[model samples]
Target: MNSKSELIKFEEGISLESGDNLSSFELMIETYGDLNDSKTNAVLVCHAFSGNHHVAGKKSNGEIGWWDEIVGPNKAIDTNKYFVVCCNNLGGCSGSSGPSSINPTTGKIYGKDFPIVSVKDWVNSQNMLTERLGIPRWLFVVGGSLGGMQALEWSIAYPEKILKAGIFAAAAKSSTQNIAMNEVGRESIRKDPNFNNGDYIELGVKPKNGLKTARMLGHITYLSEENMDLRFGRKFQDSNSKVDGKVDFEVENYLQYKGEKFTENFDANSYILMTKAMDGYDASKNFKNLDEALSSVSSELLIVGFDSDWLYPPERGKEIQLAAMNNNIRSSYITLDGRQGHDSFLFASEKYEEIIQDFVGS
Candidate 1:
């Protein structure tokens, strides 16, 4: 599938759940396939942290989308059968209004002044976009990790708008450990000399080292110990002359490359804001409890967990399932046996793709 990204501006800005309002904003979105006459065949795919509107297919620049493996023609999500819509979240740096965007009021970058946006805010913004697109209801709303949390939110917050919800490798809220990890990443960026109080762009410098370290730490959490051992296993980078106290591990080299690559494209302020948003999201807080929160959900749910994903873990997914069951909501839980850790949902595998295909097909 060949896809093009479109930026749609909304003059009637959204009043966020936090009570802050943007006078105007734009959303970068990419769509695949075609909408049926009734617009009932729409499927919404929410992006996780660090993800943008490019979900699948190839851009004119020849760059393949992040989940191209599972979202093209005849693929898991099957763009050929359903109109797939994805957008850069409101607080994202990817062509969306965020910390990096210019503030109309001050004639400067929002930076630290950008309002704290919550998951509910994201869903609300997405809802506006949906309405603008003339989509009456979605056949499915699906995502993984932070994206999964958004999907879960949609099912509860707008139960009448979605038919099926797919939540993969996500928890209803961030655990203490997860929160701590996010805090550490935030600290790294804040402490960077170039950060300059989130004004690095104004200072004509980037927090390259800080963002690099943060991404390196995040990459570690995305993989399982078993997977790391199987792939790298303490292998040395080369047989060259040993420098005194030099780190030559192939895993270290890979992490360095990944970290460097991330710093080039991602903004430090956006990273901090996004991680904080993830940490602050607690889906059940608006209601009495998890079961109460899920009680109003009209969509059928499919929750998936990876056996090796210690980040969210299988138990977290099960907890959602238990809550949904308590409300007698139609839901299914599946734990995939994989070593890819929390990122298992992002990868395409026979079982994983098949499960999604069957769910969507049904």
Candidate 2:
């Protein structure tokens, strides 16, 4: 459980999907375990929206990472056997080059000027990191949610560079409903007077309220209706405050708390950028159909979905599996029984852990 974080700069510059060249950028990464001399026992873990490079272990502040439960020694990923590397994506706010980072030309934060980034762009940047780290190939590329999209892209984008991939709670493309939900969250921030059109950082302010509201909306989708009923039901936060109609429901209080906490660490512009990337992700976009698109993926694949995850339903996972099978790729599909919705992949359920251990160990 020794983990360390570092920043690696790409001085040669990165060419983005938008046709813009980033003069220079840095990626914040965390690594656990030793990279074997052969450099073949490496596993790359991609983080979801709002998540950073701190995948596991404690930070300098003694705060545990978002995926601490699933990535430590003897955990599903088994850092004891594999070198685990997780990096904050380029457009992320967590110690990575992003809208909040200083632009070399203007000497000011990129802010709204940050170029649009796609899942392909993220994969390219990651490939650079892999080269810099001297890793010949990733034994496995794993991720859930938006991170899952990156994992899926990797299988196709770099078929020769990965041996296996684990994709959880994700689809081949964003559904209409998915885009709509992201649009609502983006609008929430845009309408906030404090947003200042993504230039809030230079305005010497943060769009706290707007960011909080957007996070609340995003959090709702992360959970299922059954989960909400089971966790909070119709209970009131404060019985006496029911008369005022202010934060009456326990669920409202929970969402409010989550929103407030998110704004404290996440940047508003980064949120906008990440969601847009999600909206633009389509693994089959370049091909005539999904099966054709997947035909190029040579990696062993494991696709997992939650039974209660309506946002990215189990059907979507099956779609990926069927396409992989049609392409003659080795693939496995499982829909875990859970009411945790899209967030089930993040939970430490015994069954989920076993599934991952079996897949990665295989």
Candidate 3:
């Protein structure tokens, strides 16, 4: 693996035929380590929303991946042993095509005009990018949270193309409750005054406050009550609890901090669009049964869930495991005990890396 950033371009010749436009969808990708002669050592690290191609290392701009703790040279995804690659999702604000990207036809940002995205569409783009890189098949496709959804999509869509894969904190189908949460998050962005019908960028205004509030609302879903009690626990953010002050609670302060920092780089329109697409995903529509969907994949699966994760609970993973078992798929299960909730997958918690490392090794 080299420290220098390398731009691996998938030329239009080998890229996907875009349904929306004739222009090739560019995959702004970064690879760690070397692709073997057979190119079978490649492992795709799919990223969650708000993540970029700078998955494991720092880019030239100095900004790094959201999961910098993992996916490094000797880290869990271990770039030293396997060729690791992470591409920003299509319609993503990060390096990939999105609302922030310039539209060739309009001479303006794609904004709300960007076509609706889907899990299948994202997978198609990734499948093309991998092929263009000369990788025959991935050793595994592993991810957590929204990235976990992508991982599951790969297994369902091109099961034979991967050797082993893991899906963490995700469901075969986006549960209605999960979809509703996504809708509420979208509403926070859509109803913001600065949103301006998703044309705020043109009005010399960014939906910062609204986006911040949305993020704060989202931060609540990413945590558990136990974790909140341990971390916040009615603690005061400052000594002067009420000096004409508000947001006295540590949890409130914590959420506000998350919201403020997220809005600094994230675009409100991007948030709304991505969440909408996620809410609309349903693998059940394409399969006769959950087991049928599991049967299509030829890869080994490591289905993981956090016991304390309310957003996509452990039962969802058990349901996947049951389906896999019925299909006679080679699969294993791990339920981590963490009060970190859904976001536990991203942070350091227990032997998560070891579980993945061992699974891939098998």
Candidate 4:
């Protein structure tokens, strides 16, 4: 993939959905391929909650992107044919303006004082970036999970700016169960003594334990019970290391490893902010019904769901498709057979890839 990561500064600043205005801010973005003369071949790839702008390249640190499997030269996204752009969201911890960033006015980290950003805010910021890059419209806006939420929002908020969208394992709004799980994760972070009320940065400390616990809990929802059973299956991480009549299961070890790895790359405050954004997301909020809300979308839609995704579920993807179709929007829905649950979209399944290749290539 011919790609490079760069930072874009918004000199005119951006106003948040919460009525706050940032005097200046920066967004880290990664781009692949060259924009056509008309600049219409641009594809915007939105990342999941914990993901970053490094969507399809080997970074200077030698780390590959989270979605490298789906976005290289001959991959589903096909960088050789389309100019792909992915940005670190404004409230992201990964080289973007967020709670960890120093406040221009206060000369200290924004921390908890950072205004709560919603999915709409993120969309607006992305639009600004697109305009900055001289792109008139996106050929496709694609994402999975929280990224999918942003794709849906892009269609609703800026219909004229995109030709089509691909939303995978996402919903029109946060379900009750989803909100409950997010709340639990938030509680885990808040209860940690090192959290320091989200001001840990000033104290020269990080709420590592809290963030680890939150990631560990959230990870469970990303995979299906079937997957967990088939992969871990009551196996012990170390059969010889039993303590207090209990042995550590392989699953426990896996979760711990994931949690530790996540904490090493993510910020606790950003996690809270992202979950809040997810909880507050509702595409139909101001409309009478979902169909009415989606009536304004001009883009063709492709919604993909995993049969075993209990978190977002196949029914949710169907709801999005139905709403779009009822409103006379061109739309399609597909439920791929997979036991990986919500994270199935990230895997390199040939079926899933073929579906995307066909949709975008067509």
lDDT of 1 by residue, 265-300 (tens): 899999998898899889888888899889899899
List TM-score per model, in order: 0.97, 0.97, 0.92, 0.97
Poorest 10 consecutive residues of model 2 by lDDT?
239-248
Model 4 regions more than 4 Å off: 239-247
By how many angstroms RMSD does model 4 differ from the true structure? 1.8
Model 4 local distance difference test score: 0.92
lDDT per residue as tens, model 4, 1-362: 67878999888888888888888889999999999998878999999889999888787799888899899898998999999999999889989899999888899999999889999999999999999999999999999999999999999999999999999999999999999999999999999999999999989999999899899999999999999999999988876543223437888878877888899889999999999999999999989988988988999999999998999999999999999989889999999988898999888789899999999989
- Could you tally the backbone clashes for each prediction? 0, 0, 0, 0
Better of 2 and 3 by TM-score: 2
- Report clash pairs, candidate 4: none
Per-residue lDDT tens digits for candidate 3, residues 1-362, read 45333444444622222355425455677778887887778889888766777776776688867777777777877777888888887777766777877766678877788777777777878888777777889999988877887888898898778888888888777778878877778887878888888877878888888788878877888888898999889888885543225677777777877888898888887888678667766666677888877778788889999987998898888888888889888888889986689888887544887887778776
Whole-model lDDT, model 1: 0.90
Model 2: residues >4 Å from true position, as ranges?
Answer: 239-245
All candidates: CA RMSD in angstroms?
1.9, 1.7, 2.7, 1.8
